[model samples]
Target: MTPALDIAHSVSGQPWHWRGGVIDGLSGSFQPDDLVTGLLLSRGCARDEIDAYRTPTIRSFMPDPSIFRDMDQAAERIVAAIRAQEKVTIFGDYDVDGATSAALLIRLLRGLGLDAGYYIPDRLMEGYGPSGEALVKLAEQGSSLIVTVDCGAQAFEALQQAKDAGVDVIVVDHHKCAAELPVAHSLVNPNRLDEEDGAAHGHLAAVGVAFLLGAAIVRRLRDTGYFDSRAEPKLIELLDIVALGTVADVAALHGLNRAFVAQGLKVMAAQRNIGINALLEASRLDRAPIASDLGFRLGPRINAGGRVGKSDLGVRLLTTEDPEEAKAIAAELEHFNEERRAIEAAVTEQALELGKGQDNRSVALVSGKGWHPGVIGIVASRLKEKLHRPAIVIALDADGIGKGSGRSVAGADLGSAVLAAKDTGLLMAGGGHPMAAGLTVAEDKIDALAEFLDARMADDVTRARGERALQLDAVVAPGGVTPALVEALEEGGPYGMGWPAPRIATGPVRVIKADIVGTDHVRAIVAGEDGRSLKTIAFRAADTPVGQAMLSAGTTRKLWVAGRAKIDDWGPRPAAELHLEDAAWAD
Candidate 1:
């Protein structure tokens, strides 16, 4: 609880705190030298669960699929369809999570010898969720059963239309739900208002829920002796996609989600999934991907299809059997990702300029008439990061209809606020989880919506920002920051979202040299009192206070540099470098 290194504030104006409280060598079950144990404890893992956290396994973290509401019914319906060889289509959102969920089910069904079709709604034409027209069209096309993944939780009218048209809709999603549910035959979401025991897994991404459904379907088939002759589909093989969707969606990495990623990475390494392997090659990643690669490299490429190119490309790439087709899709997605980055950069610049005018408001709500709707979510995320507040970027069309995407800071429930606004008639359509949300609104109501959110979330934003501090897992001198330490800390990984990588503070060092490298990155070499020099880079911070401080420090001023220690394998011999996040003046 005490301030780390006796400093009340860092250069970024935030205090640094030891994540696990001050570690006393003799008091706790773990010794001070056991960095992994300390990291596990700081991340809310119990002392008795150290071994489990160290090696997260599906068997240890996964819950029985039957624990969720409607699990048995959904599985029974799917098994029946499998037995009947009936036509079925998976209706998914046009995002990474949706693509992966659809791909997982399609692949699972393929292994069962029942081919299923898929539909991903165009982001620009059909919007975020399933529309009544699309659902009915799929039914009219001879599909008897439809499964909507990553969406449909809020598609009240769409689901009703499907029901009226004699189509059974099974909704497997992870979004927060309203008390009055939609008219789906089965709605399985851990965040359901009526969820009892399954609510413990509210942090699952939609792909994770689909993975559970996969397990449930397999179990039902096993119970019916359907797999006695044919081998049961190895559901574990699908964890690679599950991991991709889970990390790409920024779901909390703990428990089952953690196990999904940890094991998924291994499955990914096997190169069994032709589509994933092609994507890896397209991304120029020659080695097996870690958790960060999913979020940054692979996830973005898949999302680029939904954001800028053909919406179904991701699903097509993931579910394709032909390696050549997979390679072509991956290449196309890479091109789209590059285009997406350009559009996002332009939108972000304009949004940031507009955000400066809203400093008095709790939320950075910005809208532009000509802004591309596809890139608003990424722009909103960028705004949230820079402004240190909840942000919503709305793209208004000529008809005065606005499509908005929002990203929230920690402890601020932007999704709930958006949902409340919809309930109060401020939003025409809206739904999301705690961290991110999407909405449709009349452009005229933008101001009122902003006002409503400002009033509703002001206190939460204030408290969350007020309590913000740079959390440090360990503090060591520059000499102690080595490849060995970085490797040791990795034992606590595949870290992300709720479960973060260990942040090490190594300081009492003077900057030996500093320069701006790659656009907006501050790269520096610093040496401590022990005369040991190390490299540090602060990405996209050349214009920020931390970057400015590091650049101007020169060789005279001693400072504490805090960041995630990573192994720099680019050199002839592996060495350690700091992906610096924050720094403080030590003298």
Candidate 2:
């Protein structure tokens, strides 16, 4: 069943003027399933075009890594570092992209029996970059080379410092690029300013880039006879970590990122890695790892380490081979998740309270003192949904540093904005992708940054908020949402991030029965004029927008319900049920 918030179908019933196939030679009225997963794909382009996305696979879809701007250089540099047997250090971000990239790197290096270790930046003290202090420390510890995963794209100053200190940096990052490239020794990013591929395959997260690097290293080693007649590590084995990190980082589930998940999920489901097995047990998820498991179950636990606990907890959890140690780390992360949630709630509540009466703006900036710095980004994202604006939330610490995170609406270039702000000397440091970004500012600059964002984003915000039409795929009848339909939908999944679940709109159902179920759940049976009926449930929506609307449904009123339908087995007879997404009173 779909969630209560799922809006299945959006049919602005303008009569179908063209009766025959709109195309010159087609004969059908465009069934999205024939080409796309759900009605959603049909909205963007022709059905035939979307068909390729339905069943994602490794062989059918993998793009050559060399297509990325700096992949070749990145590959050669990584292999050369490995051959030298240098004390290599992988500097990573604290999030899933960072951890998974670190894990993938660790797996690859260990497979070749090299001395490679990774360090993740501390979320609180070091922030999100290759800290100069840490880089100097690594050099002192005999680290001759450092490869940054998931970060360092914007670390021009830090990379300069590392270079001056006699440490080589092979940066493996996928963040948004700036006008001027950083000075890392071997910077490898698809988003490099000079990338000429029309593929524009910069959508991959850091972990995806690392996977490619792993593949490149293996290829190079094999070519050079380094693995001559010797057992070589299957680079594909690291896909599990790659997939988990890519999905967790919320990278677009397209192109190479899709390949990573397709291969990685298989490895994860099979429990190939001992540490991953321990994580699975700790998360208490279904044996098979689905995209949902990564999003809801695993990603959060991994992130908990960076949010309220040690930044290395995630790396520790991912790299440990011992079941006992992995299990212990998993438990600690689980506890940290609880703490993170509490802190997130507290920060969000305060932000919302402070922004109660703001007016007519394209951006919302909220600030709080002493709120946990780690959760501001999530809170900013939450506000973006409610207010439909580019939102930035900041929490100031006693040291007078404002830790801020921002989530942008469609069409806003958040990372660029942060870069611009930094260029103008208003920020201490900040850079990220368009949709998500972070910045560190002096405590006094929050209001100034807000004003700067408001001016820069006014036109874009107004254009987007004025566009509020719901997107629908195709309309379905109660009978159409059968077990067969559910199975068909699964073919396109596991969906998350950029690729969303499909929503089908059903007829204006007459309220046959409706009642509030579980603590805050709403359940009912909605029927059509032909007597066909389907059960529906809306979880955790008792007094919310959809909840209030459902409770008001009566026999006389015909309402359109849009959402994903799932087979519910809780009843004696397993039956189809609509997970109420959104509802509108019929005209």
Q: How much lDDT does each candidate structure score?
A: 0.91, 0.75
Counted clashes in each candidate structure? 0, 8
**Per-residue lDDT of model 2, residues 1-587, tens digit only:** 22122323333222112111222101213343552434335333246645455555666666677776667777787787777777999899998888888888987898887858889888988788888889989998999889899899888888888989998888888877777887877777877777777137678788877877777778878889988766899877778888888788777777667667877898888788877787788877644777767876899889889989999988888888888899899989989988888888778778877766666667888877888888887789778865667888988989888888899876777887888888888899888887889889998887788888778778877877666445444466665667666655556666666666655667667888889875568998888766788888877567566667778878888877767767674667656788875677664
TM-score of each: 0.97, 0.88
Name every residue pair that clashes in candidate 2: 6-581, 8-503, 8-504, 8-562, 8-563, 9-505, 10-472, 39-473
lDDT of 1 by residue, 1-587 (tens): 21248668888889988898554311113333476787888999999999988899999999999999999899999999999999999999899999999999999999998899999999988899999999999999999999999999999999999999999999999998999999988999999999999999999999999999999999989988998999888999999999999999999999999999999999999988999999999999876688999999999999999999999999999999899999999999999999999999899999999998888999999999889899999999989988899999999999999999999998999888999999999998999988999999998899999999999999999999999999988776676667777767788888999999888787688999999988689999999786889999999899988899999998899898889888885788889899998998988
Q: How accurate is candidate 1 locally (lDDT)?
A: 0.91
- The candidate that wins on TM-score is 1
- Candidate 1: which pairs clash? none
